[model samples]
Target: MSSKLEQKIAEFRITFIAEFNDKLAVLTKLWSNARTSQSLEAVKKFRFEVHSLKGSSGALNFLTLSNRLGIIEEKIAPCEEQINSLKTVIPFIDRHMNSMNEASRNTPNSLLVLQEAASLLGELRDPQKNKEEITPQSYRDIKIALIDDNENTSAVNAKLLAGFGFTINQFNSIEQLEKVLQKNTYNLVLIDTDNSTNPSEKMFAFAVKLRTFDTDVFILSSSSSFENRLSAVRSKVNEYLLKPVNITTLVSKIRKNFKIDLIRPYRILLLDDQALVGSFYKTLLEDEHVEVLAISKADAIMTELESFHPDVFLLDMHMPNISGLEVARLLRQQAKYDYVPIIFLTSDDNIKTKLEVLECGADDVISKSTPPNIIVQQVDSRIQRGQEIRYLASRDSLTGVLNHGQIMDAAAHSLRLSKRQEKPAVVVMIDLDHFKGVNDKYGHLGGDKVLVSLGQLLLQSVRDTDYVGRYGGEEFMVVFSNATPRVIESKMNNILTAFLHINYTVDKQSFNCSFSAGLASSTDHEKLSELISSADAALYQAKDAGRSQICVDVLNK
Candidate 1:
């Protein structure tokens, strides 16, 4: 068989074993309780547990184990009727439970036990079906409404959001918005408050109306005045953005409020020589929704490790060609996987052995007898910490966007891609309008909020394929792939329109903020620096034209 196919089967085996182990653990407990209680209810519970185990084991292709469990379940079936005959049933229960435990410890022996148990029970039918079970349904469809008078702004926002799998409906008037809200449910309502007279009152009333329908509201306004912010607070607006809002920030806010994560499942690489033991560990991790790749041959470990890019490594101490300690050392030599957790699983309880393993680069040592729940918890904790560390290293501390170096690196990569594909990529230099004035008026804390808000806006506005970053204080940058100068300008304009409506408050005083952006496309320059410089120059022109507008650089071909 092909290595890939073999690996796939091994992975499935691991997952099945993990699940079976958990079921067995529960069955062990239930059996013990049933024996002591000797009640009809206890017997029924035991039967149900065994029945479930039979079905699951069968579904996972553990036919031997399934058949054995099925026989045991069948024997317990008549226990409720023969509840008074507890003494007679207890011996049968104990015998089966001991056989099952022994079979679990040695999977190969399970078939022999199954045959013996079947003979004693007379006839045993297959408990597993041929087909796989259906997966549960995913998250429901997410729909949003973008209400704004500017058709250009609405269209751009709608297009960007639609790319994120949202159904967007545009509305130019409150009446039109109300009509849609009354007729259909929307996950979120994004309204442009720039045209409203008494924007605060209008927003509050609109929010009140939305609340009746249990809809989330986001307001877009050019003014960040005290009254407006207070109104948003009163109306419990989910998000308040200034006109020319960052599309990235808007999308992020929507996702945050809605609790959405695009990151895939945590991946784990398991290394063990014993197929059964490796499969068991793999199953344990998979039960926690982790993606695991199990490799029995030490020679295949590096290949699997490189391909899987696992967040954590589970290694068995004793192997044919290579020890777990040696594998950990080999992994540690690779700089990329340096911080990746290496957990050693072994039956060896020797203190000297564990210390030696740790010294050899294993992060933690787990006994083979460790409970499934504890194993999962330890692995999850380590993975989470690793992720958190990576996040902090890659993200801006305050705004939670890409830091300067990370953004530049991303831009460089995007530029390389653009050059290779011969596709146009645009970079926008963004500056918050009158940002210093905000600090002077409301202190640095308020200014920080404006910066954070803009950062969030830019992060949300850009496509997942695009890169947005905090360039420096009061400035940001967005790298858009396969975008023309005109398209970038239009999108930035839409962001500007939305950004102007963001409200900020300081000691009862409220104000709004705006931003000016300059767009430069890859067609203008071969280098990221040149593109950024051109964008910066155009951004100055935007400021000169008056704040809160997007300007495109007139690049000579």
Candidate 2:
């Protein structure tokens, strides 16, 4: 095989291994959980992993592997059978996964075995069907209303949606539509701007009211006028379909705007001097719903930028001539693009240079010294941060945490995730004991040094998935998802030990600062305010019983 194809195969093997590793980790965690909740979560996670692998293998044209994975996914989705069933299959699955890892371009028998296993899965689902089993559906019954004065357009649009299993309501005018909306609840409302009372004004008012019901509002217009599209967007229309809509495009827009199986592929731009580097990144990123743009030269970046408006810029900082930092600066300066996040990849071990590049506008500076997996993770984090910033308010300058208002928003988000995942998520409330005494003893600058050290320490020690925010002056809150009381206590102990080591210097004079933390888990359904209150009560207890120690209070102390 040629070198390029060989590299591609190697990358695929790595991705397959990583995915299996992730599933194994999740399965291990599920097995260790309490019996009451074990199967449900384990089954869900297992199914999700297998389903993901099925699609991935299918896309790669690994028919046998895809088919087998499909069967495994189906079996695990309804893992209601005893845990012994899993125990029995887990060993076989592990061996098969290992076989995939060992198999090469010449391993046809392994492929045949995978195919047979896949075929057997269909038999398990329905013994009669000798064919592949269709995956179970989770289609939601969505009610949508279309308002258009034109009879022909409304009928055509409604009929098109009916084929997709949507229940459609048709209205001839704004007045009729208003009455229908008031009388019935709809998931989405489609308005034809051409037939509105005052296209701009009425559309805006309708959008506000429709949004109150949390329904998606969309505009259908034949005008195709830029002004009309702008007005529709201003009126908070989720999307606008131009007149003489192609049925496919219209259906796609409807499904996409409504988030109905409209999964977007992640877009990754890989810039490197080496063709192998770009190809490797492309292969890895493509497996995760990503569109990879591999460019080898800094000069060709503009061409790629024009054709592919990538969500992220993964630029090589060591590129000749105009470096990644230079390109990043240019991109940020452009009026068309300043929001696009840039992550620079460098082999240089110098931290000072890396910090300078970050200051130059790169969102993240990742070392090429790390593994490819770490590189992918760092890129994912940078992209996730950009997405999160849209929903989060400005972070606090002092504590580097979400300010007062943003904390509630983050708490609510963590709460929902905790409940859905059925995992333990904890909130740790921390307060500096005798904070005022320290400020008085060491001066305000010394107090500031302590807070900065605490922030840095927390960010460094916590898991990447965990969130830490400055709740207020001398107080911080941590959102620890998928964490237990013991795990959280261990983390807190580390924090206390680390805090003791931090040497705070003010005016070249050294000083010391200490803190106490209290943790409460989200095992029960409690409000965000209530979770914090419980944590705060525990914090008080820790403070009352000598500070600088971690405490977990089950009683609402």
Q: Once superposed on the true structure, which residue ranges of model 1 sit more than 4 Å away at CA?
A: 1-362, 365-372, 409-427, 462-467, 479-491, 519-538, 551-557
- Cα-based RMSD of the predictions, in order? 16.4, 25.6
TM-score of 2: 0.36
Question: Where's the lowest-lDDT run of ten residues in candidate 1?
Answer: 130-139
Tell me the tens digit of each residue's lDDT in model 2 across 105-218: 335433432443233223223322122211211114568888887898788778656643468889987678777566799878888777556656777678778888878887
How would you encode candidate 1's per-residue C-alpha lDDT over 1-557 as one tens digit per residue?
A: 22343355446545555566666778999888888898888887777667545533443345566666767766777677888776776787689789778867877523432343222111112232322211221123567888878787777777656543468888887777776665799878888877644345765798878977868899888888888888898888888888777655675566555634224567898877656556656765675567899888888886554235677888877664457788889889966576678887765546887899879877788765444445666887887666556555666765667789878977887787788778888988999888888898888767766776676667667776787888998889899998888777778888888888777766667788889888898886998899999999999998999878888887821
lDDT of each: 0.71, 0.64
How does model 1 fare in lDDT?
Answer: 0.71
